[model samples]
Target: MGPESAGSAQRSHVDRLYHLPMITPQGGRRSAMVPDVEVDFGAGPTTVPSTMRYVDLTGNGRIRVPAQGAVDWSQLNKLPECITVEWSGADRGVVEAVAARQIRFLYWHDASGTVDLTGTGVTDVRLDGIGLRSVRLPESARVLLLREPPESLEVDAPESGHRMDLRLFSRGPDIRIPGGLSRVSELWLKVAGTVSASVLTGLTDLEELRVSFDDPPGVFADAQDLQAHRGLRTLQLDDAYDWDPGNLPELPSLRGLEINGTRRATATVVKARFKATDVRISIHGAKSEAWLAAHMSNPFRDWVEDSKPFGAAACEAYTRARSAIEALAPTASDRMAVAEHALRGLIAALNAIDAEYQLIDTLRREQAGEVFFELAAQAEVPVDQARRWFADRDF
Candidate 1:
């Protein structure tokens, strides 16, 4: 697939497309050490004026250069706090020239052809565009980002104690997370094709993960079986419904789940299944009450109507409980009296039942213990009794 689609285009083009004139800072000497410079590029020929306008991005010690065509930063020998270069043209000698500046942190934004970084000395670099050649990346690289998927990727870096973050949007076949990418703590992947779960198998130390699939049928059929990534704390899934529900791996540290493009009904059911897993789920998009009711733990008349057994000695009790629970809001006169009374009677009938209902067993088996506890609390009954009632029999 080419970059013609809306979702698959380069991020810079999607966000900010530069068409203005390029500005190259020019100054012979300064009294107090010059910290940063802002360079902007246009479509015309390269012009290095003796003086140019100064623009600040973050209002700090960082250089923000947005330009086109070849760039030369060879004069900057002293490393600044940070350097950001945004260009749409590739220059084979630009990396060597920038290396002479001894940059500490670099933000390279390019949309043209590939640029080589064989001997660049930047400790942290965020490479943008799709033509990045990783073989030339220095071993001193600590933080890296392929803003877009690369045609050729080479994993080379020293064994430093620093943790790295790798973010990329890739739809290519040749790109793969190199096994040598050690100490990677955060990984963000936006994919468009089939990918295996094993790509993330060895990333045990990963703490944050965000994955989005642009394919309609979903490409991560193999990624559904998450293989015990205990360190993962935050997982955001976008348009990823290829994985089967109820098959998620046990993540002890996982606490936040952000999901998009998943049906609300499925999200509700899955959230109930992981209630004991203690994850805070945030489902995006519109939601309906029907989806919410499908996963409710409380026994209702609907279940009885569906030929599902309820723990009611009298059918009227089940009917009453169902009506009470389903009511969106009670009238000011009745308030919750109708539902509360129905619940008391329903609990009494349930206590007298000797046979077990499949609904209760299903709730317990799915680890939706809190739902029952909430029901008990709403019914003015003890939670311990509800827990014991749920634990009474097996399905």
Candidate 2:
């Protein structure tokens, strides 16, 4: 398909905005470093700037350039390992500049046209809201996350001892696995159309695989092809339709299997097939209430289990929060409002018990955020609004 068609598919597939956290210095302070000679791209041609603004000097070594002006990179005294450029008109010169500096992580937003990173030392790359028709990656590239699949992709094999992680979230039916991605260890394909057995041809080292169909009638062509992936440990299938699990290979290394939004009969067959194995299976959507109650436990129960005598207050607080959310009327506005209130209550309870440190020190804040999002999703809350429920959180 053409870029226009692919772009349309992307919009439908990803209806939610992802708010990625930026790395900042401790105490939430940021110092701006302006370029030595700031040349206006809108004006006549001039020398490339030697320095750039918004360079994170102290923390994780990052440079964030906005989409307003042209950035012709010049040699800097200190180059950051992570660079984020939010320009839709970035071209080959930008790629060359980044390649020369050997950036480690690159987050390019709203990039357009073609760009090649032939010999860059970048280990991780994330392309979000891109309009590129093609992209070429160097052999040193390890992790690639694409919000929209490009019309053409050329990825060289990773260096020795390095494995690639390829994630593509596309709604197009023409999503093809590139040839040189044989070293990919983790693959996530959230797309449409039939997934042929040839798609797994060289993915022998794949450890984790997740396939989610965006449209109905899209199916996996063959289950026998999965036998080659002996290292596969985790497999997730979401919104799967017209797919059979009866002939699935016996993956001895499989530990976690999840099948969501599929036919109830299919789910039952899968359960029966893996009932004797040690694999932890999770089947949801179009399932019985009894099955759901038995399989899906409270999100905070694990936290309560991990904490003992000192966690009594936290357990009580989380229990109340869960109850509050569960008691909300099945309305979007009510869910959003009640979820926000419950989250604030939980945070207050934590602060009252002098356990706020646990939220930060033990990463309980992330857990709490995920729990709230899960509850919100279950209630059909829009992801963007649900995400904002935690915006005013104190803990």
Candidate 3:
């Protein structure tokens, strides 16, 4: 038999499943049969004849295009499939053309540099480490996995249509989420710097939110920011264990709350506050009684009490350290190390004061003698002054 006869016999199974169109002339069909491309898309296996310059595996509803320098989709008649566009070289036109074909899913991987998916009819997109500057996700977009920051990002949402459920992993001191796309239902932001609450102001209809706060106050400052989210149901506060219950918002719509890194005193208040409320609560890293005992044993807490004389000394130390750190040039690399050391001292002083205050507050509320004497002896003030202060107290 001739080469064409053998090629036809080899491709007979794949041809029956997916017709591999011809790209070469009938005379040269013999040489084209040398290399056949096999692809698997869940169902089983199918091969493309070497004769065709391109293959259309979209018949099975999935397409995996390797990183070719440039691809002509028109060669395969532009089938509507969930296209996986892997990073090869610059192929803006190829991506645009595929999007223009109104494909439902676009899995963009390893493609760096600026990418603009403005008019893409893609509904679900999984983007990995793409330097996305101009991002205009279609209103049809429902799910998105954005794992890296674009130099600049702007989402152009369709005026009247479906909303997007986005998971963004971007870090910054000034992270900007465009005011446009307001239909985000669920948003999970794993940010490095403190993200302003204003970023989510327009997403009023948001239901679930998970965020990491370098400073929890940034999110708690505006009550209306979370209160305005009438549809909000779940909120996960990551790295907010140090947060006090007083800073927590009164979101009537909130049903589930998750808090991590909670101090024992703060955790107690949080649990008490949420007990009567319908919101289900979960707490992690809550300090145990032993943790409280450890603090009580420290002499610094006793010395940092609300006594006016102690306050005066503490204030001077804190102010002096802060001023010394601030005097250094902000741009200097050594400034951070100096500032960090100064801040450490300041934090220790502040923590001592906070522990003393928390202990006093707990004693006032619970009226337990054990709470008073635990750190009362550690008070750095004169023994006589400490006695007078503790004796006069109604605990």
Query: Highest TM-score, which number?
Result: 2
Clashes per model (N, Cα, C within 3 A): 8, 0, 4
Per-residue C-alpha lDDT of model 1 across residues 212-289, encoded as one tens digit per residue: 664533445554456467778888775554455565677788888877545556677777877766788876532344
The clash number for model 3 is 4
RMSD, one per candidate, in order: 22.2, 11.7, 23.1
TM-score-better candidate, 1 vs 3: 1
Better of 1 and 3 by lDDT: 3
Q: State TM-scores per candidate.
A: 0.48, 0.52, 0.47
Question: What is the C-alpha lDDT profile of model 2 across 34-151, one tens digit per residue?
Answer: 3334333332333333433223311123333344555536533243432433333455355666677745666676666655676677666777554665567777776777776565
lDDT of 1: 0.50
lDDT of each: 0.50, 0.59, 0.51
Assess candidate 3 and give its TM-score to the true structure: 0.47
Query: Which residue ranges in model 3 land beyond 4 Å of their true spot?
Result: 1-68, 72-89, 92-105, 109-121, 127-131, 147-152, 160-162, 213-224, 284-395
Error of 2 at 152 (Å): 4.5
Regions of model 1 farther than 4 Å from truth = 1-82, 88-92, 100-124, 128-133, 136-142, 147-152, 160-162, 173-175, 286-395
Pull out the clashing pairs in model 1.
20-42, 21-41, 21-42, 22-40, 22-41, 22-42, 23-40, 41-67
Kindly give the stretch of ten consecutive residues in candidate 2 with the minimal lDDT sum. Answer: 11-20
How many Å off is the CA of 178 in candidate 1? Answer: 2.8
